[model samples]
Target: MYRYDEFDQQFVSARVEQFSDQVRRRLSGELSEDQFKPLRLMNGVYLQLHAYMLRIAVPYGTLNTRQLRKLAHLARTYDRGYGHFTTRQNLQFNWPSLEQIPDMLRELAEVQMHCIQTSGNCIRNVTADHFAGAAADEIVDPRPYAEILRQWSSLHPEFSFLPRKFKIAVSGAAHDRAAVRIHDIGLQVVKNDEGQIGFTVFVGGGLGRTPFIAWTLRDYLPEADLLTYCEAILRVYNLYGRRDNKYKARIKILMHEAGLDTVRAQVEEEFERIRGGVLTLPEGDVARIRAYFAPPAFESLPAVSLVETQTAARDPGFAAWVATNTHAHKVPGYVSVTISLKPVGGIPGDASAEQMEAVADLADAHAFGEVRVSHQQNLILPHVKRDDLPAVYRGLVAAGLATANAGLVTDIICCPGLDYCSLANARSIPVSQRISERLGDPARQAEIGPLLIKMSGCINACGHHHVGHIGILGVDRKGEEFYQITLGGSADEVSAIGDITGRGFSSAEVVDAIDTIVNTYIAHRASPDETFLAAYRRLGMQPFKEALYGNA
Candidate 1:
């Protein structure tokens, strides 16, 4: 994890002071709601349906146990006992009072965390794979690069007010866990023909009203020119991206209208102008950043833990948890454990203050005092020793953070819809809750295999319904909630937008429809080993549609 330097510390301290005064003015009526809107938004405060929601950036989804404990304290002191982890790998205090926000910001600043750049029409939090440094399949760790971009883009003069909000996500592994293709800017670590490390840059991918898979702007961007090339893309977008229509303001719409070649040519021209300039990252600077992210010390141990194997062999519950919730680590004796926030019928990413503190404690005891937030709304202990799996599981179970379902059907990604979001046309949480309850059994989910059921309250795609294996979109029809289903979507290396199934289901019929879809896939899949995504892609949407609407 990258720690703030003296300059970084001073910068945050100044911003917190500025925002604190701004908040005071707003509360005292010196600033009206209309006058305070931009100020509050700039500070990451959103006036949601019921109350204010403060989104705090979790840079590259990495936090030390101390930072996590501080957040737990803030959640306990202010708000209503819980914080919601968002699809951006950020945390949102959904019920924070406007008056309490300044103190909250001050508290966050104490731990090198802040709500800066979390909202408004500028660069948002730069996210990377949650398993960045630890994943066995990763080519390189992308967080250091992400941090570099953060340093360059934070409070940059030019991009302060783009056509709309911008999001950048980085993925270092071959598997694309960061949903790279669906961000305003996506960077994938790649090795060139010369065996030199670089990036494969994608531009204009986003998932709002008009979802788009980013175009390959540069197949191989040299590591040194990262900032320069990135500046070129931003310059082109800022120069021509729409400002008239809010709906068409995103870079994705620009990519759709301008075409990839046109944008690429413009970006290349800009890059040529800026290359070898101040923006080019020096080798020493790169090395320094890389050194900051060096892996923690590990004891020399065998690949398999004998105690772990024996315990799992005895306890079916432990075996199930181990089977689903743990991932292979780069280090032989360690594993990355996923603490699923999705309980049987709980809100997808809502973690209570107590739960956060417990996870912080677990990270201190087992992991390297580090906690990670996954884009899929789960918390990750990125470096847990395999030998300590049972004790970790027990601790998680005690804290109500143990849900055993990671990639299974019940491990759903859902947005807070009509319940909290003002933009929602329908309720997403209760619907997902019902679906979870319907398929909550561990055996049933295990049988179903890896399934991603994402639900969005609207077309904003906050739940990433665009790329879900079983995608559900809620729409308002004649003052009633109707859910639309999309099939065969995935957010992996072979990213694909889900195809819509005809018509919509009533809220009452939605869960049953999902069951129908799942059962249809199970019946038609070639083997138990075949995943829901594979089955859907193999059989196409015909069988699933027939099952949902009936052949008649």
Candidate 2:
């Protein structure tokens, strides 16, 4: 976790003061909704379908126990009893009163958190892999670079008002867990043959009315040149990205019009001029930032052999959770555990106030007081000893935080659609809940195997439906809710945008449609060994389409 420095502290505090004044003005009627819109957006407050939704950034999704506890407090005291974790790994409160927002901001600043850049047409939260510093295959921690970018871009003069919101993601591991390819600007940390750290930069990747996987702009950019290179890309987007039409204003639209080669050429030209400019990071700045994120001291312990066997034998629920939620750790005898927010029939990324507090307590008790909010909308205790698994599982189960589904069908990633978002055409959370209820059986899910089922309110792809093996996009059909399904999408090493399988399914029929697809895969797969994604890739959408439509 990157600790807030003096500059960060001052910036957030000052912004809170400013927003407080703005909120007063709005409440006093000096500022109308039109007049106050931009100010509220800059602070990450939105007037949603039913109420005002406040989105607070959890930069790169890393939080300490203290931070987690603070979030819990906010959910309990200020708004509803729950907070929704977003696909970007931030948290959103669905029903905050307009006047209470400033107070909330002040409270968040106390814990070194803020809602800045969680919304607006600027560089939003710079996301990274959830296993950033702890991944076994990582070459280096990506958080320092993310933090550096955060400082440089926060309220940047030119970028503060862009044609549309821009997103950036970075990854240090060989596997792209951060979904770097789906962001507007993606960076993969790499080392050259000379052992010098740098980045593999990608541009024009985004999902909305248009979807694109980023094109690699540069293979090996020196670490010192990161800011300079990133500046070049943003400068290009800001100068020429469409602004006349909000729907077609993202960098993806520009990439479509200008073509990838021309856009790359423009960015490269800008990079050449700014390579050694003031924006270039100071020597060893990365190391200095990294000091704040140094890994917690871990203990040397042998693997808990008896504990593992006993857990599998004694508690089938714990065994199921371990199978899906526990991940490989860099350290021996330590496992990273995902605390699933998507319990059967619950909101996909929501954590109740009590659940948040319980997670914080568990993190402090068994995982060295650190926690991570994953891009998949789950929480991670990144360094738990294998011996402590049962105890942690028991605690999580007691708190209603233990669900065995991590990457399963029921573990769906969905945005707060029509229920909360002003831009949505349909309600995503309810749709997700219905799907979970329909397929709530653990044995059924295990039979289905590993699958990524993602849902988005619209083409904006907030829930990243573009990369889901079974992607569901909600749309408006003459005042009725309809969902468009896509198949064969993936967000791994071999990333691909899902192709639409057929016409949209009615809201009532969507869940059963998905069940049909899953059952079809199970019945027709070469073997149970083949996962949903594997079978989809090998057999393509033909069989699944046949299974769904059934020869008209």
Best by lDDT: 1
Q: For model 1, where is the 10-residue window of minimal lDDT?
A: 543-552
Highest TM-score, which number?
1
RMSD of each: 0.8, 1.3
Q: What TM-scores do the predictions have?
A: 0.99, 0.98
| Model 1 / residue 315 / CA error / Å | 1.0
What lDDT tens digits, residue by residue, belong to model 1 across residues 176-221? 9999999999999999999888999999888868888889999999
Per-candidate clash tally? 0, 0
True-structure lDDT of candidate 2: 0.89
